[model samples]
Target: MIIAEQKPIQEIKAMIAGYQKVLIVGCDTCVTICMAGGRKEVGIIASCLRMALQIDRKKPQLIEDCIQRQCEWEFVDTLKDKVDGVDAILSSACGVGVQALAERFPNKPVYPALNTTFMGMPNEHGLWVENCRGCGNCGLGRFGGICPIARCSKGLLNGPCGGSQNGKCEVSKEMDCGWQLIYGRLKTLNQLDQLEDILLPKDWSTDRDKGQRKMFRGDVYYEQTV
Candidate 1:
C-alpha cells in the first residue's frame, strides 16, 4: 500500500489560513490502512485545525469529508458538489491523491496535508516498512519473494554487499541485510541453486525517470471513455 504521514499542524495552518473555507478530503484506501488519511484522521485533523485557528483569532470554516479514493476520477467526482462551496482543498491522502484532486479541480488550490513516503506494508501495529520500489520490472521470483532492489540499502540485485556483518546491513545495525534475508529464504525453500543464476540488468524503461507511466487493459477499458 502507499504509505504517508500527515504534515505538521503549523504547516497546514499556513497553507489554509488565507482561504475563507477549506475542505479536507480523506482517502479510504491505502492511507486508511496505514492510519494516515482516513475518516478518523480527517476528524482528528479538522478538530486540531479548528482549535489552532481559534488561537490565532481566525474563524475556522473547515469542512471535513472522506471519499472511497482520491486517486480515481470516479471517486474524485464526488467532490464536485463539495468543491463548489470551498475556496481551498486540503487533502489528507497520499501525494497521488493530492495530484488527482489538483487535476480534477484545477481552479481550486489543492494542498497536500501528508507527505507520501513509499510503497510499503504494515510491519506491526503502527509500523510500516518499505518493501518494493515498483521498479517497473518484477524479479521477486529469483530472490524467493524478497525484493533485493527495495530491501537492500544500495538496491543490490545480485547479493548482499560484503559490508554486511552478522546478517545486519552495514548501513545500520537495526536494519537486516536484505541479501542475507534472501539467502535464508532461498535456503528454506531448497532453491539455493538458483543463486548461481545471473539476473538481468534492471529495465530502466519502466523506471520513474522514463516519465509519466500508464497502463491499460483493453478487456476492461473502453476507448471511448479515454
Candidate 2:
C-alpha cells in the first residue's frame, strides 16, 4: 500500500488561513489503511481546525468529506456540486490523490495535508514498513521474493554488499540486509540455486519515468463508452 502521514496541523492551517471557506477532503483507500487520511482522521482534523479557528478569532467555514478515492475522476465528480462554495480544498490523501483533485478542479486551490511516504506493508499494529520501490521492473523471481531495490540501502541488484554484518544492513543496525534475507529465504525453500542467476540492469524506462504508465483491456470496453 502507499503509506502516508498527515502533515502538521500548523502547516495545514497556514495553507488555508487566507480562505474563509475550505474543504477537508479525505481518501478511503491506501491512506485509510495507514490511518492517515481515513474518514475518522478527516473528522478529527476538521474538528481541530474548527477549534483552532475559534480560538484565533477566525470564523473560517470548514467542511469535511471522504470520497471512495481521490485518484479517480469519477469519485472527485461527486464533490463538484458539494464544493461549489468552498474557497480551497485540503486533501488528506496521498500526493497522487492531491494532484488528481487539483487537476480536476483547476479553478480551486488544492493543498496537501499529508506527505506521501512509500509503498509499504503493515509491520505491526501501528507500524508500516517500506517494501517495494515500484521500479518499472520486478525481479523477485531471482531474489526469493525479497526486493533489494527497495529494502537495500544502496538498491543493490546482486547479493549483500561487503557492509552486511550478521544478516543486518551496514547502513543501519535496525535494518535487515535485503540480500541476506533473500539468501535465507531461498535456502529455506531449497531453491538456493536461484541465487546463482544474476539479474540484468533494470530498464527503468519501462516504469513511470517512461511517462504515465497505463494499461487497458479492450475486452472491458463498451461501444457506448468508446
Candidate 3:
C-alpha cells in the first residue's frame, strides 16, 4: 500500500490560518491503514485546530469529513456539498489524493496534511518497511521475491557488495544485506544454480528517470449518464 505520515500540526495550522473556513478531508484507504489520514485522525486534527484558533481569538469555521478514497473522481465527487461551504481544503490523504483534489477543484486551494513516504507494507505492528521501488522493471523472479533494487544499499544486481558482515549490510548494522537474503532464499529453494547466470546492466530508462508513467486499460470504458 501507499504509506504516508501526517504532517506536523503547527505546519498544518499555518497553512489554513489565512482562510475563513477550512475543511479537513480524510482518505479511508492507504492512509487509514497507516493511521495517518483516517476518520479518527481527521476528527483529532479538526478539534485541535478549533481549540488552537479559539485561543488565538480566531473564529474560522472548521469541519471534518472522510471519504472512501480521494484518488478516484467518483469518491471525490461525494465532497461537492461539503466543499461548497469551505474556503479551503486540507487533504489528509497521500500526494496522489491531494493532486486529485486539486485537479477536481481547480478554483479551491488544496493543502496536503501528510507526506507520502513510500509503497510498502507493515512488517509488524506499527512498523512499516520499504519493499519495492516500483521501477517499472521487475526482476524478482531471479531474486526469490526479495527486491535488490530497493533493499540493497547500492542497488546491486549481481550479488552482495563483499562488504557485508554476518549477513548485515555494510552501510548499516541494522540493515540486512539484500543480496545475502536473496542467496539464502535461493539456496533453500534449491535454485542456487541460477545464481551463476550473468545479468545485463539494468535498463533504468523504465524507472522514474523517464518521468511520470501511466497504464491504459482497453477493457474498461466509461458510461455516459443522461
Query: Of the candidates shown, which would achieve the greatest TM-score relative to the real structure?
Result: 1
- Model 2 scores a TM of 0.92
lDDT of all predictions? 0.93, 0.90, 0.92
| RMSD, one per candidate, in order | 1.4, 2.0, 1.7
- Which candidate order results from sorting by lDDT in descending order? 1, 3, 2
> Which of the two, 2 or 3, has more TM-score?
3
lDDT of 2 by residue, 1-226 (tens): 9999988888888888899999999999999999999899999888887787788788898889999999998999999986788999999999999999899989999999999999999999898999998886788887889998898899888688999999899889999999899889999999998877786777788668867788778998665753
Q: Each candidate: how many clashes? A: 0, 0, 0
Worst 10 residues of 2 by lDDT: 217-226
Model 3, 1-226: lDDT tens digits are 9999988887888898899989899999999998889999899888888888777788898888999999999999999888888899999999999999999988899999999999999999899889999999999999998999999999988888889899999898999999999999999999999889989999998898878998767688656676
In model 2, which residue pairs have backbone atoms overlapping below 3 Å? Answer: none
TM-score to true structure, per model: 0.96, 0.92, 0.94
- Compute the lDDT of residue 209 as modeled in candidate 1: 93
Indicate the worst ten consecutive residues by lDDT in candidate 1: 217-226
Residue 221, candidate 3: C-alpha displacement in angstroms: 4.2
